[model samples]
Target chain A: MQESNARVGAPDWLEEIRWNADGLVPAIAQDAVTGDILMMAWMNAESLRLTAEEGQAVYWSRSRGKLWRKGETSGHQQVISEIRLDCDEDVILLKVEQKGGIACHTGRRSCFYRRLEGGQWASVDPVLRNPEAIYGKKQGGSNHE
Target chain B: MQESNARVGAPDWLEEIRWNADGLVPAIAQDAVTGDILMMAWMNAESLRLTAEEGQAVYWSRSRGKLWRKGETSGHQQVISEIRLDCDEDVILLKVEQKGGIACHTGRRSCFYRRLEGGQWASVDPVLRNPEAIYGKKQGGSNHE
Candidate 1:
Protein backbone atom coordinates (compact mmCIF):
# COMPACT_ATOMS: atom_id res chain seq x y z
CA MET A 1 0.00 0.00 0.00
CA GLN A 2 3.00 2.32 -0.43
CA GLU A 3 2.66 5.50 -2.45
CA SER A 4 4.03 9.04 -2.65
CA ASN A 5 3.43 10.99 0.57
CA ALA A 6 2.23 14.18 -1.08
CA ARG A 7 -1.46 13.36 -1.00
CA VAL A 8 -3.78 15.54 1.06
CA GLY A 9 -6.52 14.91 3.68
CA ALA A 10 -5.99 11.59 5.44
CA PRO A 11 -2.95 10.77 3.30
CA ASP A 12 -3.02 8.11 0.61
CA TRP A 13 -1.62 5.48 3.00
CA LEU A 14 -4.50 5.76 5.45
CA GLU A 15 -7.06 5.73 2.66
CA GLU A 16 -5.67 2.43 1.40
CA ILE A 17 -6.91 0.69 4.53
CA ARG A 18 -9.80 -1.64 3.80
CA TRP A 19 -11.77 -0.87 6.90
CA ASN A 20 -14.46 -3.31 7.82
CA ALA A 21 -18.10 -2.45 7.29
CA ASP A 22 -18.07 -1.06 10.79
CA GLY A 23 -15.11 1.17 9.98
CA LEU A 24 -12.87 -0.83 12.29
CA VAL A 25 -9.55 -2.59 11.82
CA PRO A 26 -7.79 -5.10 13.99
CA ALA A 27 -4.69 -3.66 15.68
CA ILE A 28 -2.08 -5.77 17.40
CA ALA A 29 0.18 -4.47 20.14
CA GLN A 30 3.56 -6.17 20.44
CA ASP A 31 6.31 -5.46 22.91
CA ALA A 32 9.00 -3.58 20.98
CA VAL A 33 11.97 -4.97 22.85
CA THR A 34 10.71 -8.49 23.54
CA GLY A 35 8.60 -8.97 20.40
CA ASP A 36 5.96 -10.56 22.56
CA ILE A 37 2.42 -9.89 21.44
CA LEU A 38 0.85 -7.99 24.29
CA MET A 39 -2.74 -7.62 23.13
CA MET A 40 -5.09 -7.26 20.18
CA ALA A 41 -7.66 -4.51 19.93
CA TRP A 42 -9.74 -2.63 17.39
CA MET A 43 -9.20 0.85 16.01
CA ASN A 44 -11.18 3.16 13.82
CA ALA A 45 -9.73 5.80 11.55
CA GLU A 46 -9.91 8.43 14.25
CA SER A 47 -8.26 6.26 16.91
CA LEU A 48 -5.52 5.24 14.50
CA ARG A 49 -4.83 8.85 13.64
CA LEU A 50 -4.85 9.83 17.28
CA THR A 51 -2.48 7.00 18.17
CA ALA A 52 -0.02 8.11 15.52
CA GLU A 53 -0.23 11.68 16.69
CA GLU A 54 -0.17 10.91 20.41
CA GLY A 55 2.67 8.33 20.26
CA GLN A 56 0.68 6.00 22.49
CA ALA A 57 -1.89 3.25 22.19
CA VAL A 58 -5.49 4.21 21.37
CA TYR A 59 -8.10 1.61 20.59
CA TRP A 60 -11.76 1.45 19.64
CA SER A 61 -13.85 -0.42 22.13
CA ARG A 62 -16.53 -2.35 20.30
CA SER A 63 -18.60 -2.87 23.40
CA ARG A 64 -18.22 0.64 24.77
CA GLY A 65 -18.57 2.12 21.28
CA LYS A 66 -15.90 4.72 21.85
CA LEU A 67 -12.20 5.45 21.76
CA TRP A 68 -10.11 3.94 24.56
CA ARG A 69 -6.77 5.46 25.38
CA LYS A 70 -4.49 2.82 26.77
CA GLY A 71 -3.60 3.19 30.44
CA GLU A 72 -6.48 5.59 30.98
CA THR A 73 -7.23 3.92 34.26
CA SER A 74 -4.74 1.15 35.08
CA GLY A 75 -1.47 3.01 34.52
CA HIS A 76 -0.25 0.49 31.98
CA GLN A 77 0.32 2.67 28.96
CA GLN A 78 2.09 1.54 25.82
CA VAL A 79 4.68 3.82 24.32
CA ILE A 80 4.61 3.40 20.58
CA SER A 81 7.98 2.79 18.93
CA GLU A 82 6.69 1.88 15.47
CA ILE A 83 3.49 1.14 13.62
CA ARG A 84 3.15 -1.20 10.66
CA LEU A 85 0.23 -2.32 8.52
CA ASP A 86 -0.20 -5.64 6.89
CA CYS A 87 0.04 -6.08 3.12
CA ASP A 88 -3.72 -6.19 2.64
CA GLU A 89 -4.10 -2.96 4.59
CA ASP A 90 -6.55 -4.66 6.90
CA VAL A 91 -4.40 -5.19 9.98
CA ILE A 92 -2.29 -2.75 12.00
CA LEU A 93 0.64 -3.79 14.18
CA LEU A 94 2.26 -1.60 16.79
CA LYS A 95 5.66 -2.06 18.34
CA VAL A 96 5.49 -0.44 21.73
CA GLU A 97 7.41 -0.32 24.99
CA GLN A 98 4.82 -1.67 27.40
CA LYS A 99 4.80 0.40 30.57
CA GLY A 100 4.51 -1.35 33.95
CA GLY A 101 5.64 -4.57 32.26
CA ILE A 102 2.01 -5.63 32.18
CA ALA A 103 -0.33 -5.61 29.21
CA CYS A 104 -3.28 -7.71 30.34
CA HIS A 105 -5.95 -6.35 32.62
CA THR A 106 -5.69 -9.70 34.37
CA GLY A 107 -2.32 -8.40 35.62
CA ARG A 108 -0.35 -10.70 33.33
CA ARG A 109 2.46 -9.60 31.04
CA SER A 110 0.28 -10.32 28.00
CA CYS A 111 -3.32 -10.99 27.19
CA PHE A 112 -2.18 -14.18 25.54
CA TYR A 113 -1.10 -15.84 28.74
CA ARG A 114 -2.83 -19.11 27.95
CA ARG A 115 -1.74 -21.76 25.47
CA LEU A 116 -3.71 -24.54 23.87
CA GLU A 117 -2.61 -27.95 25.07
CA GLY A 118 -4.32 -31.28 24.40
CA GLY A 119 -7.52 -29.59 23.25
CA GLN A 120 -7.62 -27.42 26.32
CA TRP A 121 -6.41 -23.92 27.01
CA ALA A 122 -4.04 -23.79 29.97
CA SER A 123 -2.79 -20.64 31.63
CA VAL A 124 1.00 -20.78 31.39
CA ASP A 125 1.83 -17.32 32.61
CA PRO A 126 1.58 -15.96 36.14
CA VAL A 127 -0.30 -12.83 37.01
CA LEU A 128 2.17 -10.16 37.99
CA ARG A 129 -0.51 -8.31 39.97
CA ASN A 130 -4.00 -9.00 41.08
CA PRO A 131 -6.71 -7.49 38.95
CA GLU A 132 -8.58 -6.29 41.99
CA ALA A 133 -5.55 -4.27 43.06
CA ILE A 134 -4.69 -2.95 39.58
CA TYR A 135 -8.17 -1.73 38.57
CA GLY A 136 -9.89 -1.62 41.97
CA LYS A 137 -13.32 -3.21 42.41
CA LYS A 138 -15.61 -1.05 40.29
CA GLN A 139 -13.29 -1.15 37.28
CA GLY A 140 -12.49 -4.84 37.50
CA GLY A 141 -14.49 -5.68 34.36
CA SER A 142 -13.41 -2.60 32.38
CA ASN A 143 -11.02 -4.46 30.12
CA HIS A 144 -13.67 -6.83 28.80
CA GLU A 145 -16.06 -4.08 27.97
CA MET B 1 -12.60 -18.41 29.72
CA GLN B 2 -11.94 -22.01 30.59
CA GLU B 3 -14.53 -24.23 32.23
CA SER B 4 -15.41 -27.90 32.53
CA ASN B 5 -16.13 -29.26 29.03
CA ALA B 6 -19.55 -30.69 29.92
CA ARG B 7 -21.81 -27.83 28.90
CA VAL B 8 -24.32 -28.58 26.15
CA GLY B 9 -24.88 -26.67 22.91
CA ALA B 10 -21.98 -24.21 22.63
CA PRO B 11 -19.22 -24.70 25.17
CA ASP B 12 -19.00 -22.34 28.15
CA TRP B 13 -15.66 -21.06 26.92
CA LEU B 14 -17.10 -20.04 23.56
CA GLU B 15 -19.98 -18.28 25.24
CA GLU B 16 -17.52 -16.17 27.20
CA ILE B 17 -16.36 -14.41 24.03
CA ARG B 18 -17.64 -10.87 24.01
CA TRP B 19 -18.47 -10.75 20.34
CA ASN B 20 -18.86 -7.41 18.66
CA ALA B 21 -22.27 -6.03 17.81
CA ASP B 22 -21.79 -7.85 14.53
CA GLY B 23 -21.09 -11.10 16.32
CA LEU B 24 -17.47 -11.26 15.20
CA VAL B 25 -14.05 -11.59 16.78
CA PRO B 26 -10.67 -10.69 15.32
CA ALA B 27 -8.45 -13.68 14.73
CA ILE B 28 -4.72 -13.49 14.17
CA ALA B 29 -2.86 -16.20 12.31
CA GLN B 30 0.76 -16.74 13.30
CA ASP B 31 3.26 -19.06 11.75
CA ALA B 32 3.66 -21.99 14.11
CA VAL B 33 7.31 -22.54 13.28
CA THR B 34 8.56 -18.95 13.06
CA GLY B 35 6.10 -17.19 15.36
CA ASP B 36 5.67 -14.62 12.60
CA ILE B 37 2.19 -13.21 12.33
CA LEU B 38 0.99 -14.12 8.86
CA MET B 39 -2.40 -12.44 8.67
CA MET B 40 -5.47 -11.25 10.55
CA ALA B 41 -9.05 -12.10 9.78
CA TRP B 42 -12.50 -12.07 11.37
CA MET B 43 -14.38 -15.06 12.66
CA ASN B 44 -17.93 -15.60 13.79
CA ALA B 45 -18.97 -18.21 16.29
CA GLU B 46 -19.64 -20.77 13.59
CA SER B 47 -16.34 -20.14 11.88
CA LEU B 48 -14.47 -20.34 15.17
CA ARG B 49 -16.22 -23.56 16.03
CA LEU B 50 -15.40 -24.99 12.62
CA THR B 51 -11.78 -23.94 12.79
CA ALA B 52 -11.41 -25.68 16.11
CA GLU B 53 -13.15 -28.78 14.89
CA GLU B 54 -11.51 -28.91 11.45
CA GLY B 55 -8.03 -27.99 12.65
CA GLN B 56 -7.59 -25.44 9.86
CA ALA B 57 -7.90 -21.75 9.25
CA VAL B 58 -11.41 -20.42 8.62
CA TYR B 59 -12.37 -16.76 8.55
CA TRP B 60 -15.41 -14.58 8.11
CA SER B 61 -15.17 -12.35 5.06
CA ARG B 62 -16.71 -8.99 5.84
CA SER B 63 -16.83 -7.85 2.25
CA ARG B 64 -18.54 -11.02 1.10
CA GLY B 65 -20.40 -11.73 4.35
CA LYS B 66 -19.56 -15.39 4.35
CA LEU B 67 -17.21 -17.93 5.82
CA TRP B 68 -13.88 -18.36 4.00
CA ARG B 69 -11.75 -21.46 4.05
CA LYS B 70 -8.13 -20.48 3.82
CA GLY B 71 -6.15 -21.79 0.82
CA GLU B 72 -9.38 -22.77 -0.91
CA THR B 73 -7.95 -21.38 -4.12
CA SER B 74 -4.19 -20.90 -3.69
CA GLY B 75 -3.20 -24.07 -1.81
CA HIS B 76 -1.75 -21.97 0.99
CA GLN B 77 -3.91 -23.43 3.74
CA GLN B 78 -2.96 -22.95 7.37
CA VAL B 79 -2.98 -26.19 9.29
CA ILE B 80 -3.81 -25.06 12.77
CA SER B 81 -1.48 -26.29 15.50
CA GLU B 82 -3.16 -24.42 18.35
CA ILE B 83 -5.94 -21.97 19.03
CA ARG B 84 -5.94 -19.37 21.78
CA LEU B 85 -8.27 -16.76 23.17
CA ASP B 86 -7.07 -13.52 24.61
CA CYS B 87 -7.77 -12.72 28.26
CA ASP B 88 -10.51 -10.33 27.26
CA GLU B 89 -12.15 -13.08 25.22
CA ASP B 90 -12.43 -10.80 22.23
CA VAL B 91 -9.44 -11.88 20.16
CA ILE B 92 -8.35 -15.25 18.80
CA LEU B 93 -4.90 -16.49 17.90
CA LEU B 94 -4.06 -19.40 15.67
CA LYS B 95 -0.71 -21.07 15.41
CA VAL B 96 -0.59 -22.77 12.07
CA GLU B 97 1.77 -24.37 9.62
CA GLN B 98 1.36 -22.20 6.54
CA LYS B 99 1.40 -24.48 3.54
CA GLY B 100 3.23 -23.42 0.37
CA GLY B 101 5.31 -21.08 2.55
CA ILE B 102 3.06 -18.20 1.54
CA ALA B 103 0.36 -16.61 3.64
CA CYS B 104 -0.31 -13.42 1.75
CA HIS B 105 -2.10 -13.49 -1.58
CA THR B 106 0.75 -11.25 -2.79
CA GLY B 107 2.96 -14.35 -2.40
CA ARG B 108 4.73 -13.10 0.70
CA ARG B 109 5.37 -15.29 3.71
CA SER B 110 3.31 -12.93 5.86
CA CYS B 111 0.85 -10.17 5.10
CA PHE B 112 2.87 -7.95 7.49
CA TYR B 113 5.64 -7.38 4.96
CA ARG B 114 5.54 -3.61 5.04
CA ARG B 115 7.34 -1.67 7.73
CA LEU B 116 6.59 1.94 8.55
CA GLU B 117 9.69 4.00 7.80
CA GLY B 118 9.97 7.77 7.77
CA GLY B 119 6.22 8.25 7.59
CA GLN B 120 6.03 5.79 4.71
CA TRP B 121 5.47 2.10 4.46
CA ALA B 122 8.35 0.30 2.81
CA SER B 123 8.03 -3.32 1.78
CA VAL B 124 10.86 -5.19 3.49
CA ASP B 125 9.84 -8.73 2.59
CA PRO B 126 10.34 -10.18 -0.87
CA VAL B 127 7.58 -11.95 -2.71
CA LEU B 128 8.36 -15.66 -2.98
CA ARG B 129 5.97 -16.05 -5.92
CA ASN B 130 4.00 -13.74 -8.17
CA PRO B 131 0.32 -13.17 -7.43
CA GLU B 132 -0.57 -14.10 -10.98
CA ALA B 133 1.20 -17.43 -10.53
CA ILE B 134 -0.44 -18.18 -7.19
CA TYR B 135 -4.10 -17.43 -7.90
CA GLY B 136 -4.21 -16.69 -11.63
CA LYS B 137 -6.08 -13.62 -12.93
CA LYS B 138 -9.62 -14.40 -11.83
CA GLN B 139 -8.63 -14.98 -8.21
CA GLY B 140 -6.13 -12.14 -7.96
CA GLY B 141 -8.15 -10.21 -5.37
CA SER B 142 -9.47 -13.21 -3.51
CA ASN B 143 -7.55 -12.44 -0.36
CA HIS B 144 -8.81 -8.91 -0.03
CA GLU B 145 -12.49 -9.68 -0.18
Candidate 2:
Protein backbone atom coordinates (compact mmCIF):
# COMPACT_ATOMS: atom_id res chain seq x y z
CA MET A 1 0.00 0.00 0.00
CA GLN A 2 2.77 2.40 0.90
CA GLU A 3 4.74 1.65 -2.22
CA SER A 4 1.80 2.26 -4.56
CA ASN A 5 0.81 5.37 -2.66
CA ALA A 6 4.28 6.78 -2.97
CA ARG A 7 4.01 6.50 -6.74
CA VAL A 8 0.46 7.80 -6.98
CA GLY A 9 0.95 11.45 -7.82
CA ALA A 10 2.28 11.06 -11.34
CA PRO A 11 1.55 12.97 -14.53
CA ASP A 12 -1.12 11.81 -16.93
CA TRP A 13 1.39 10.76 -19.56
CA LEU A 14 2.63 8.00 -17.31
CA GLU A 15 -0.80 6.43 -17.13
CA GLU A 16 -1.59 6.45 -20.84
CA ILE A 17 -1.54 2.93 -22.35
CA ARG A 18 -4.18 2.27 -24.94
CA TRP A 19 -2.72 0.38 -27.87
CA ASN A 20 -4.11 -0.31 -31.27
CA ALA A 21 -4.86 -3.76 -32.57
CA ASP A 22 -1.33 -3.79 -33.93
CA GLY A 23 0.02 -2.80 -30.53
CA LEU A 24 0.70 0.77 -31.48
CA VAL A 25 -0.60 4.23 -30.66
CA PRO A 26 -0.37 7.56 -32.38
CA ALA A 27 1.89 10.20 -30.82
CA ILE A 28 1.74 13.78 -31.91
CA ALA A 29 4.57 16.24 -31.36
CA GLN A 30 4.11 19.99 -31.18
CA ASP A 31 6.05 23.07 -30.27
CA ALA A 32 5.30 23.97 -26.71
CA VAL A 33 5.81 27.68 -27.20
CA THR A 34 4.33 28.25 -30.63
CA GLY A 35 1.69 25.54 -30.46
CA ASP A 36 2.90 24.36 -33.80
CA ILE A 37 3.06 20.65 -34.49
CA LEU A 38 6.56 19.44 -35.20
CA MET A 39 5.77 15.88 -36.36
CA MET A 40 4.00 12.65 -35.62
CA ALA A 41 5.01 9.00 -35.18
CA TRP A 42 4.07 5.75 -33.54
CA MET A 43 5.08 4.16 -30.26
CA ASN A 44 4.65 0.79 -28.64
CA ALA A 45 5.57 -0.12 -25.13
CA GLU A 46 9.28 -0.35 -25.81
CA SER A 47 9.42 2.68 -28.04
CA LEU A 48 7.44 4.66 -25.53
CA ARG A 49 9.88 3.63 -22.88
CA LEU A 50 12.80 4.77 -24.97
CA THR A 51 11.34 8.25 -25.41
CA ALA A 52 10.78 8.76 -21.71
CA GLU A 53 14.21 7.47 -20.93
CA GLU A 54 15.82 10.07 -23.14
CA GLY A 55 14.89 13.74 -23.20
CA GLN A 56 15.24 13.72 -26.97
CA ALA A 57 12.19 12.74 -28.93
CA VAL A 58 12.08 9.10 -30.12
CA TYR A 59 9.70 7.11 -32.26
CA TRP A 60 9.17 3.70 -33.85
CA SER A 61 9.87 3.57 -37.54
CA ARG A 62 7.17 1.43 -39.08
CA SER A 63 8.96 0.85 -42.35
CA ARG A 64 12.46 0.61 -40.95
CA GLY A 65 11.26 -1.54 -38.09
CA LYS A 66 13.55 0.13 -35.59
CA LEU A 67 13.73 2.81 -32.94
CA TRP A 68 14.52 6.32 -34.20
CA ARG A 69 16.35 8.82 -32.04
CA LYS A 70 15.84 12.50 -32.79
CA GLY A 71 18.83 14.85 -33.21
CA GLU A 72 21.41 12.07 -33.05
CA THR A 73 23.09 13.60 -36.06
CA SER A 74 21.03 16.51 -37.35
CA GLY A 75 21.07 18.28 -33.98
CA HIS A 76 17.42 19.29 -34.15
CA GLN A 77 16.66 17.66 -30.81
CA GLN A 78 13.26 18.00 -29.13
CA VAL A 79 13.48 18.59 -25.42
CA ILE A 80 10.17 17.55 -23.98
CA SER A 81 8.32 19.68 -21.46
CA GLU A 82 5.05 17.79 -21.25
CA ILE A 83 3.17 14.77 -22.60
CA ARG A 84 -0.57 14.33 -22.58
CA LEU A 85 -2.90 11.48 -23.50
CA ASP A 86 -6.39 11.90 -24.82
CA CYS A 87 -9.38 10.46 -23.07
CA ASP A 88 -9.32 7.32 -25.18
CA GLU A 89 -5.65 6.75 -24.38
CA ASP A 90 -5.00 6.07 -28.05
CA VAL A 91 -3.47 9.42 -28.83
CA ILE A 92 -0.62 11.39 -27.29
CA LEU A 93 0.31 15.05 -27.54
CA LEU A 94 3.89 15.99 -26.81
CA LYS A 95 4.99 19.47 -25.89
CA VAL A 96 8.66 19.94 -26.67
CA GLU A 97 11.45 22.44 -27.06
CA GLN A 98 13.04 22.35 -30.51
CA LYS A 99 16.75 23.03 -30.61
CA GLY A 100 17.28 23.99 -34.25
CA GLY A 101 15.58 25.40 -37.29
CA ILE A 102 13.08 23.48 -39.38
CA ALA A 103 11.77 20.27 -37.90
CA CYS A 104 11.20 18.66 -41.28
CA HIS A 105 14.21 17.22 -43.04
CA THR A 106 12.63 18.44 -46.24
CA GLY A 107 13.97 21.89 -45.31
CA ARG A 108 10.65 23.32 -44.25
CA ARG A 109 9.99 24.31 -40.66
CA SER A 110 7.02 22.00 -40.76
CA CYS A 111 6.26 18.95 -42.91
CA PHE A 112 3.07 20.42 -44.38
CA TYR A 113 4.26 22.45 -47.31
CA ARG A 114 1.76 21.34 -49.94
CA ARG A 115 -1.72 22.73 -50.28
CA LEU A 116 -4.75 21.05 -51.81
CA GLU A 117 -6.66 23.46 -53.98
CA GLY A 118 -8.68 23.45 -57.17
CA GLY A 119 -8.09 19.73 -57.58
CA GLN A 120 -4.42 20.56 -57.80
CA TRP A 121 -1.68 20.86 -55.25
CA ALA A 122 0.55 23.89 -55.09
CA SER A 123 3.88 24.96 -53.61
CA VAL A 124 3.36 28.16 -51.71
CA ASP A 125 6.57 28.60 -49.72
CA PRO A 126 9.98 28.98 -51.26
CA VAL A 127 12.59 26.37 -50.61
CA LEU A 128 14.66 27.45 -47.64
CA ARG A 129 18.09 26.26 -46.51
CA ASN A 130 18.96 24.96 -49.96
CA PRO A 131 18.59 21.18 -49.82
CA GLU A 132 22.16 20.98 -50.93
CA ALA A 133 23.13 22.87 -47.81
CA ILE A 134 21.21 20.51 -45.58
CA TYR A 135 21.67 17.11 -47.22
CA GLY A 136 24.73 17.58 -49.44
CA LYS A 137 22.79 16.22 -52.38
CA LYS A 138 22.74 17.44 -55.93
CA GLN A 139 19.13 18.55 -55.21
CA GLY A 140 17.61 16.12 -57.69
CA GLY A 141 18.77 12.71 -56.66
CA SER A 142 16.40 10.87 -54.26
CA ASN A 143 13.41 13.08 -53.46
CA HIS A 144 10.23 11.90 -55.11
CA GLU A 145 8.98 13.54 -58.26
CA MET B 1 -19.66 33.86 -63.21
CA GLN B 2 -16.53 32.14 -64.45
CA GLU B 3 -14.47 33.28 -61.48
CA SER B 4 -17.23 32.35 -59.05
CA ASN B 5 -17.69 28.85 -60.48
CA ALA B 6 -13.97 28.35 -60.66
CA ARG B 7 -13.71 29.22 -57.02
CA VAL B 8 -16.59 26.93 -56.03
CA GLY B 9 -15.17 23.79 -57.65
CA ALA B 10 -11.68 24.50 -56.44
CA PRO B 11 -10.30 22.17 -53.81
CA ASP B 12 -11.19 23.24 -50.33
CA TRP B 13 -7.60 24.08 -49.59
CA LEU B 14 -7.63 26.94 -52.04
CA GLU B 15 -11.20 28.04 -51.82
CA GLU B 16 -11.03 28.49 -48.07
CA ILE B 17 -8.39 30.64 -46.54
CA ARG B 18 -7.80 30.74 -42.84
CA TRP B 19 -6.84 34.33 -42.23
CA ASN B 20 -5.46 35.13 -38.85
CA ALA B 21 -4.72 38.62 -37.67
CA ASP B 22 -1.90 38.56 -40.20
CA GLY B 23 -3.78 36.73 -42.94
CA LEU B 24 -2.12 33.41 -42.20
CA VAL B 25 -3.29 29.99 -41.18
CA PRO B 26 -1.87 27.21 -39.08
CA ALA B 27 -1.03 23.97 -40.87
CA ILE B 28 -0.55 20.61 -39.23
CA ALA B 29 1.10 17.65 -40.90
CA GLN B 30 0.33 14.09 -39.96
CA ASP B 31 1.42 10.72 -41.29
CA ALA B 32 -0.99 9.61 -43.99
CA VAL B 33 -0.96 5.91 -43.21
CA THR B 34 -0.05 5.82 -39.52
CA GLY B 35 -1.91 8.94 -38.45
CA ASP B 36 1.15 10.08 -36.52
CA ILE B 37 1.58 13.83 -36.61
CA LEU B 38 4.90 14.94 -38.07
CA MET B 39 4.99 18.70 -37.65
CA MET B 40 3.19 22.04 -37.77
CA ALA B 41 3.88 25.27 -39.65
CA TRP B 42 2.25 28.40 -40.97
CA MET B 43 1.11 29.62 -44.38
CA ASN B 44 -0.50 32.57 -45.95
CA ALA B 45 -2.53 32.48 -49.15
CA GLU B 46 0.65 32.91 -51.11
CA SER B 47 2.59 30.35 -49.11
CA LEU B 48 -0.16 27.83 -49.60
CA ARG B 49 0.05 28.35 -53.33
CA LEU B 50 3.75 27.58 -53.42
CA THR B 51 3.21 24.16 -51.90
CA ALA B 52 0.63 23.15 -54.49
CA GLU B 53 2.45 24.78 -57.36
CA GLU B 54 5.66 22.94 -56.64
CA GLY B 55 4.18 19.59 -55.61
CA GLN B 56 6.40 19.71 -52.54
CA ALA B 57 5.72 20.82 -49.01
CA VAL B 58 6.57 24.44 -48.22
CA TYR B 59 6.13 26.72 -45.23
CA TRP B 60 6.61 30.24 -44.05
CA SER B 61 9.59 30.38 -41.73
CA ARG B 62 8.68 32.93 -39.11
CA SER B 63 12.13 32.88 -37.62
CA ARG B 64 13.90 33.40 -40.92
CA GLY B 65 11.11 35.43 -42.47
CA LYS B 66 11.08 33.50 -45.71
CA LEU B 67 9.11 30.97 -47.62
CA TRP B 68 10.83 27.63 -47.14
CA ARG B 69 10.56 24.70 -49.48
CA LYS B 70 10.99 21.23 -48.15
CA GLY B 71 13.33 18.61 -49.68
CA GLU B 72 14.71 20.87 -52.35
CA THR B 73 18.09 19.78 -51.11
CA SER B 74 17.52 16.95 -48.71
CA GLY B 75 16.39 13.66 -50.19
CA HIS B 76 13.68 13.51 -47.59
CA GLN B 77 10.80 15.08 -49.49
CA GLN B 78 7.16 15.09 -48.57
CA VAL B 79 4.92 14.55 -51.61
CA ILE B 80 1.55 15.86 -50.61
CA SER B 81 -1.43 13.79 -51.74
CA GLU B 82 -4.22 15.59 -49.91
CA ILE B 83 -4.94 18.57 -47.68
CA ARG B 84 -7.72 19.01 -45.16
CA LEU B 85 -9.01 21.99 -43.23
CA ASP B 86 -10.91 22.01 -40.02
CA CYS B 87 -14.24 23.77 -39.52
CA ASP B 88 -12.61 26.77 -37.93
CA GLU B 89 -10.62 27.59 -41.09
CA ASP B 90 -7.83 28.60 -38.77
CA VAL B 91 -6.18 25.20 -39.02
CA ILE B 92 -5.18 22.92 -41.89
CA LEU B 93 -4.10 19.30 -42.22
CA LEU B 94 -1.68 17.95 -44.77
CA LYS B 95 -1.55 14.36 -45.98
CA VAL B 96 1.81 13.56 -47.47
CA GLU B 97 3.93 10.91 -49.11
CA GLN B 98 7.16 11.10 -47.14
CA LYS B 99 10.25 9.53 -48.69
CA GLY B 100 13.98 9.31 -48.02
CA GLY B 101 13.26 8.05 -44.50
CA ILE B 102 12.40 11.08 -42.39
CA ALA B 103 10.36 14.15 -41.68
CA CYS B 104 12.79 15.51 -39.13
CA HIS B 105 16.17 17.10 -39.75
CA THR B 106 17.35 15.15 -36.70
CA GLY B 107 17.03 11.92 -38.69
CA ARG B 108 14.01 10.63 -36.89
CA ARG B 109 11.29 9.33 -39.20
CA SER B 110 9.04 11.82 -37.46
CA CYS B 111 10.25 14.90 -35.65
CA PHE B 112 8.72 13.68 -32.41
CA TYR B 113 10.82 10.94 -30.90
CA ARG B 114 10.18 11.34 -27.19
CA ARG B 115 7.46 10.24 -24.85
CA LEU B 116 6.59 11.44 -21.37
CA GLU B 117 6.14 9.07 -18.50
CA GLY B 118 5.66 9.56 -14.79
CA GLY B 119 6.57 13.26 -15.23
CA GLN B 120 9.84 12.29 -16.90
CA TRP B 121 10.66 12.14 -20.58
CA ALA B 122 11.53 8.87 -22.29
CA SER B 123 13.22 7.94 -25.58
CA VAL B 124 11.00 5.85 -27.82
CA ASP B 125 13.04 5.35 -30.98
CA PRO B 126 16.51 5.05 -32.47
CA VAL B 127 18.34 7.19 -34.95
CA LEU B 128 17.26 6.37 -38.50
CA ARG B 129 19.60 8.14 -40.92
CA ASN B 130 23.11 9.31 -40.18
CA PRO B 131 22.84 12.93 -39.10
CA GLU B 132 26.35 13.60 -40.27
CA ALA B 133 25.30 12.40 -43.69
CA ILE B 134 22.31 14.72 -43.61
CA TYR B 135 23.43 17.79 -41.69
CA GLY B 136 27.23 17.68 -41.42
CA LYS B 137 28.78 20.29 -39.09
CA LYS B 138 25.56 22.23 -38.75
CA GLN B 139 23.93 19.65 -36.54
CA GLY B 140 27.08 17.90 -35.36
CA GLY B 141 28.16 20.69 -33.07
CA SER B 142 25.31 20.21 -30.64
CA ASN B 143 25.89 18.42 -27.36
CA HIS B 144 23.96 15.37 -26.14
CA GLU B 145 23.98 16.77 -22.61
List the DockQ of the predictions in order.
0.48, 0.09
TM-score, prediction 2? 0.48
Please, what are the lDDT tens digits per residue for candidate 2 over residues A38-125?
5556666566656666766776665556666765545667787777554334566777897775666666665445555576446554
- Chain B TM-score against the true chain B, candidate 2: 0.79
How high is the lDDT of residue A43 in model 2?
66
Residues A28-124, candidate 1, lDDT per residue (tens digit)? Answer: 9988887678899888877887788899999888778888999988899999998889977888999899999998999999898777665566898
Judging by TM-score against the true structure, name the best candidate. 1
Evaluating just chain A, the predictions reach TM-scores of 0.90, 0.76
lDDT of 1 at A56: 97
Candidate 1 segments whose C-alpha is farther than 4 A from its true place: A1-9, A62-66, A116-120, B1-8
